[model samples]
Target: MIGGSGHVGARAARALRRLHPDLPIAIAGRDARRAAAVAAEVGGPTTATTADVGRGDLGLERGASFSAVVTLVKDEASNAVKRAQADGVPHIAFSDFVSEIGPLVAHHVARPTRAPILLLGHTLGGAATLAALHLAQDLRSVDAIAIGCVVDADDRGGPASQADFERNEQIGQAALVLQDGRWTWARGDAATRRFADAEGVEQVGHALPLMDVVSLAAATDALSIRVDMAARDASTRGAGHATDLVVEVSGRLDDGTAARLRYDIVDADSYARLSAYGAAIATERLLGLEGGPPVGPGLYHPESLIDPARAVARLEELGARVRRTRS
Candidate 1:
């Protein structure tokens, strides 16, 4: 684990430990003392190491090796990914914005890695996309998909998450949406969307450049796909500490009937925990800890590798509730 000293990273480490008890884990960050503290908290065969993504080898020993490298911090230099590719270790990073990932994608395309490199920058690290797929399983042909993530105003995540949030604001990146089978960048009024929350209350969301649009479009061939994010106070739902993901899909059924479906994945904990759960699930899939074949080399999205049914089950096990809201 890289950047494994922050709040979300600590949760992710615990989640991974819960799922794989005997697995050897490493908590790496620039602050060795902080990383060691988190590693001690997780217990078991975990260790703490210093990392410098500015280095090609990630500041590790010349011949160090690992089963996988999960990154929680942003690698603007792409050095972590480059090291992973060079080492042929499966890798997944959670802190990538749509605009910043293009060069990394291009680099992988130019020289594909021998180990699976997953791009999982979606809401909750691709959990929202997985839930959306599970909800659309009954559909025969998907025409459109709109994903909304409502975060509680009081639920400011860890330092890394807050930093990422600020970066998104400063970047002022236009939302990436699929429209009429063509990918488009939406801005201004076009980026604003109104949707129903889990409680059926109207909520205003602004389009965000999340990886969900690209993954959903590729997985379902949806002509219209976008993900919007909104922030609401706890009082809005008469509940403190709740984050919800609303997935709405419109398409044709197996009977050739037009239909629309919606589901809500509500987590009583903070979005940071939900996101950590997602990262843990992705790590398991990448390493084949769930009694399946490990993912092979090449680039991939979480939807391609994760089983929606299994993912939903895991989410429920992690204390997240999924409910059908509309039919």
Candidate 2:
């Protein structure tokens, strides 16, 4: 995997190892030493390679043997896509957390790469997406879907997250959901929701411009989809900040039946731990050990990309409790 040296990538490498010990894992980054260190920590036959994904060529042999490739580097999504295409490997891109910035970057970066590219945005990329899919399983048709998250205050994020936040403030427009099959953009008060989880009954949540919900709606059969983020308190507010996330999806089934699904993640650990676990879960799924279809090309959210049951089970094993709330 490219970018295996960074926080997300390194943690993902370790998670993949634990989830599938027999799988061969390798990490590549611009900094050889850091990559080597991460590989060592992961143990097994992890190899460290010196390559810059942004610069292309990653230094891999033309006929190199590998099942798939995951890119966790921070930057334009298009760049990641291009590099993955060059390597002719299935690509999994890290979620940028915030929805406003991810799609903007992805719009510019998705082109160029012919390889199947999956654009991941936040843990919602996997968990939220899969949950939506799972919730829709019993239904025939769904009119609209909403994904909600209530994060803890202590979660910290990586540089990419920091950059995305900075850009969001500059843009001054929150990414809106795709409602009724249209892109709706708005900048105003986020929707508020009360969440009762392991943490407590917290009035925690806001309607943030999340790309995953919008993208999921656009890509899936759902006509309308919304994603919201709510935190426990002010201390947890800000970019790269950490908090527990509560995800909920409500919509009408294809047969005009009402369906709703709720899931939650409480991170007692530091913010770094949350980010690491999210990345690791995605990596493990891509490796074909933890869950879902064989790793392949295309942009995706956790819900659309992997099996919900398997994804939730993996998250629980990582210390995150996946619970369903009463509809």
Models 1 onward score TM values of 0.93, 0.76
How does candidate 2 score on lDDT? Answer: 0.62
Q: Which regions in candidate 1 have their CA more than 4 angstroms from the true location?
A: none
lDDT of each prediction vs. the true structure?
0.85, 0.62
lDDT of 1 by residue, 1-327 (tens): 998887678888999898888989999988899999999999999999999776777888777788898988887788888777777888896888777788668767877856688998888888889988987898999999999988888777877778887898788758898989888888888899999888878889999888898888878868999999888877768473388888899999999998888878887777888889999999999999873788888888988899988998998887788887556
Instruction: For candidate 1, report its TM-score.
Output: 0.93
lDDT of 1 at 299: 88
Index of the highest-TM-score prediction: 1
lDDT of 1 at 297: 83
Give each model's clash number. 0, 35
lDDT of 2 by residue, 217-251 (tens): 65567776676665456463443334456555666
